[model samples]
Target: MKHVPAMQSLTPAVDARYQTLLRKLITKNGIGGKDSTAFVDDAKKQKLKTDESSIPLPVFEKGIHVNQAPPTSSNGLNGNSPTDDSTSDLSKTVSSTQDDRANDVKDEIMRNVLTIPMLKYDDLKAATDNWSDANLLGRGGFGQVFKGVWLNSLVAIKRLRDTDARNRELIRELCLNQYRHDNILPLYGYSFGGAEACLVYQFMACGSLEQKLRSKSHYPPLTWSQRYRIAHGVARGLQYLHTMTGTPLIHGDIKPANILLDQCLMPKIGDFGLARKGPYGEERTHLKVSRVHGTRPYLPDEYLRSRCLSPAVDVFSYGVVMVEIASCLPPIDRNRPVPLLSDWIQQQARDGLDFASLEDRLLQGTPHSNPGLCREFVAIGVHCTKYSRGDRPTMLEVYKRLDNLEFPGKHYM
Candidate 1:
């Protein structure tokens, strides 16, 4: 019997059994001599494999031991150690997975911040204080206008209850004309999130010209000078829209309610929801003239008969508003059934009625109570409300006429 080394006594029974099994495995695998020594040396250089199937063995005095399972291509086992390439590939796969997760997180964050699908209902509710009745400013055929505060700034919000196609078209047209001039209301934004559509505008403190004209206590009537200034301002605004912009904008629904006043009583056109761009060239026939789309009392005969409306339609509407400003009466007075405003004006012209009555009673105390200037304004209104659209002065002509008019104390040329 061979004398076993003293170091072998320190090995466990399982280790000794594994060594015996490894010897048998090496012989069965046809490993011997230098090849056997090489396999043993390779095995001794590595730590033990964690798998229970791997045999354990002690190092020889020469630091060599028989390999139970040497590195083999078939089993992917290599002396109880992983290859450099295999370890690197596994690390790369883990790193790529981490990178993909990071990219997914980044994409999700961007989608949340940048793109807003539609205005949220909660955000709108909070902005408008749940549409409180106190916020109500005015009502129209379409719906109500409300005062709202957003980001600590006052804003006017127009909510449309009517879902008419014409109303939708009007909203689209107004949005397109946002940058035309300061005389037109500035559209800050709009929301169509819920069943109802709402438009947001820079708030005008003084409200509409109609409100000022009809108010008794909280609101005061406009003086003749203020009225003249408003008329000129509105005419200039309309002229700017009709001629100066890249595309002529027609205020299809020009009325007193649509004319808003700023803090200094400067007139600014509002409610372009019914506005439309004029047809080009000979295709003017393509323009649709609805049956009396404007106020009945203010509707020109050409518009009443459904004739092709030009910018003159707006002129006609402005004329009625002008008359209303001068007379302090509603455009249509159902109580006095004598004639429509146009007919009454024609009769006044025929019978030589004094034009002084046409001046607003509120203007009696103002320094602008000059009968000569009042007559010029009445004449301008008369020309605007003419029976024929051709006879109505263009907004440009209106602006020039108003610009050249001389007041009692001030002269404009």
Candidate 2:
């Protein structure tokens, strides 16, 4: 409940200095285009060294990747070639060696995938009441979600349509297993039968932030205070995902629907099916992807145009979500001049639009009415959704700003 002064209301000189500090941090952390090639080259050099060290010993036998000095005339190596039988045997040996290496790699990956508990398919089915419609929570393109009770605790079972996506499901589970944060949705277990795969997660009573924000009649419209809390929690979660993980992760799809609210209304970021590892080194700016897989409105222009993904994509999506939290407007609102919520918010911020004009109507007369905080929060979102990916602030910067906001409730770091 500490009250900190808003940066947006400060003098122009102070604001400039603040922005300069953010830029310095971004450059120091190698989050921009500068020096990216150097980082990549250094990483490639290190990888080459590792590869050379791990290279198998040269096979001296004939026709099997032999690396020997040219044979002398006394040895008759120049004129004589290996017999057909010897050649066939060498080829088979090489093929067998490759198969063994491939299997070893596959086994290692499977071991990592099995870090989480694997529940029996029958138990999951029983918990969901044999997949009854009454226990069904929702459905998506990949699968359906069902509410269930397992081991005397509530859980959500995401049952896939078929076994085709089992590999993807396991990959997601592996990613979730490595992530442990209060703002991250916890994975309970998974079940893979011969026909289908199911991923179990901790159940959230309130459902998604999208449902609460969009479906006002079914669920009470979130107050301004609640929205602020959700925004801060999500920012902290994204920051953790970007930096705290051994390797940074990009949550490709970061819309409101992917953000779940627990019983106490704490926000937890979920849905890792589209999540991908970021660049290898701290100095690398971005990673190029062959294809993009995220909602269009939440994607930045750089990613959509070049398919080069970075942590900026998530920042852009979070900005759009922030605008929604502030205005209660959908991402695609044809009624607005800009149409796109992120773009509209960015425009408003650029024009120094008053927070009052963009504030959610329901916030009026509420105890959460703090004009300075609202303006600063919206400004942070605008900074995040900059048109140029490099121009967007890092999640750490966003989190620090949110952490400084003054509010009545106890803050969770």
Model 2, TM vs. native: 0.72
Tens-digit lDDT track of model 1 for 213-328: 88846666666678787888899999987786434666777778889988888888987755655433432422322223456676666545433446778888888777777776
Best by lDDT: 2
Q: Compared with the true structure, what per-residue lDDT tens digits does model 2 show for residues 232-274? A: 8999999998998445778889999999999989999988777
Query: Model 2 off-target regions past 4 Å?
Result: 1-108, 410-413
Q: Give the TM-score of candidate 1.
A: 0.65
RMSD of each: 33.1, 20.5
Q: Report lDDT per candidate.
A: 0.59, 0.67
Ten-residue region with minimum lDDT total, candidate 2: 1-10
